[model samples]
Target: MALTQQQRVELSSLVGDRRVDAVVAGRARMVLWRDEGRSAEEVAALAGVSRPTVNTWVRRYHDHGVPGLADRPRPGKPAEVPGSVRARILALTRMAPPAVTGLTHWSSRELANYLARHEETRVSHNFIADLWRQHGLAPHRSGTFKLSRDPAFADKVVDIVGLYLNPPDGAVVLCVDEKTQVQALDRTQPLLPIDFDRTEKRTHDYVRHGTTNLFAALNTATGTVTARCFPKRRGAEFLTFMKTIAAAYPGRELHVVVDNLSTHTTDEVKTWLADNPRIVFHFTPTGSSWLNMVEIWFGIITRQAIRRGTFTSVTRLTRAINDYVTAWNTDAKPFVWTATPSEILTKVRWVHTEVRKLLTNNDK
Candidate 1:
């Protein structure tokens, strides 16, 4: 018999519930397998039950709903561990340890020890760990997020993202940035090159051979990059790169997306922009380097070339970067932006509200 939507949902819920008796849960899973059109043998193998057991549950579920899977009173002594004790353990696991416990979280041993002392219930540490796994709880991890505090965040995001989604017909939109202080270090010992089965190996120690700064412009539409290595990341170098980019895309309007780095908006850079009116610089929101697509390319080049490759001198490192960029542009696909401006703004507003609340609480 075909299961109703509600019956299927209830059966799945019963299977997911850790509090359910093992036999009842197994029966729920077996019925669900058959509902999915699996044969008796497949259900038996999947649920770790005999073919006869599968048939019994399937027939029971077909006759009655999920309630049919309930075990008839078994002729045996009652359970050793009471239901209240199990629930208490699960509840305590969900909460932080009592401040008196002097612990941030409950480890299996600590939880077991605490429960035995407070509730006078004797349960093993292994049992506590098993309960935690069943209920899908983990208190030993953390994650992070950052909110942009730039006053003009919204406007800057709109300007840069707009260029990505819709570019002027004849304009070259470039995501420009500098990867500064790239070190060129040579390993004291030569690296062992990769072979058929062995991985490439390099010594832990290395010789510092100085560093170089890379100024790059990634074509938003073409996925190609124009890059130059400079000894310093000065506004003069930025102006020189801007001139190169202008000459490369001769006569077309240039819209460059950049971060709010001090050097990017220096007097010399501003003067250069004034002279070249066609080249406009759009800065991404502060603390939001992710908005710049060039950073993505920077990550790719670092992982593939610079991270492990040995460079005896800055000259070698620069050549390696140029080589990788050349190879990348041959098949590079433009990074697509999917988050709409409204969606981004909504998230930013929520983050702003949270940050404000935190500051207000701190002041108190």
Candidate 2:
């Protein structure tokens, strides 16, 4: 092939530039080699392509220049289901199934059957499944949510998030909560140990020895937990736990984050707080106990230590809890809070707007 100087420069740039497509670059290199008087077979060997491919690109370049070296559009098989059918499937997937159908959510087969009978749109269940996957729809799954109705929700959010992200100097921030009614459960039968292709098995029934409440204080700076188990969750127990936390970090101002539990705000607790002026309380918004970092630690302990433990007595369960706490604090790492108050407030407002729209539509 013979090329103009400008064409040669363009082809040379495409061959050398890394950003160009490999196939286009290879074709450019082949044409350049042909222009340099290299034989087709030699160019094919250098480009790792067949002689036929080299000759075909040379012919393409001769006929339509650089544009002809690129791939042609491939007309693949047309869609089996029409766009309107796909749209209807997605729209129905977002809604609860008809009450007459006695379905809480739409299964692929059920949805396909319904459409075939009612809408005269006959499609296989597999096609419905594929359509749902394509649009990221899952009617079978649902999640729970709650919006705080506290009048001071925004103020409380700002106060708590501020403590988490930017604690005051010379002060200790503790997320305090009580995990109540932790049962000591013993399996009815000995657990069958897990082996290859076999999971650990235990009886579904358990003997409940007793229950205890755990009061935990999580240090936001160091992630260490100061915890104790009590027979009851009451004002007296909460006050004692507070005293323990205060004693643990003497001579420092303490900011305790707690939920709006009645025990936490009892008259006795209030009187004690009045006496200990250095310790202050920050109440999370009602129904928003997840704000307390200790709750996250509580979940970890439950899953790791208590859930599968075969505790024959409350003392054994309490000992198990203490051991887990000791192990956790040995390698403690803080759960860093990243969400700002404004981001949280935005999401809350969006939830409120969505709920209002849903209620309004339901009334209509």
Which candidate number maximizes lDDT? Answer: 2
Per-residue alpha-carbon lDDT of candidate 1 for residues 209-250, written as tens digits (9 for 90 to 100): 999999999998888999999999888888888888899987
Clashes (candidate 2): 0
Instruction: Give RMSD (Å) of candidate 1 vs. truth.
Output: 15.8
Candidate 1 deviant stretches above 4 angstroms: 1-145, 189-204, 355-364
> What are the Cα lDDT values of the candidates?
0.76, 0.80
lDDT per residue (tens digit) for residues 257-287 in model 2? 9999899999999998899899999999986
- Looking at model 2, residue 136 earns an lDDT score of 70
Model 2 segments beyond 4 Å from truth? 1-145, 189-204
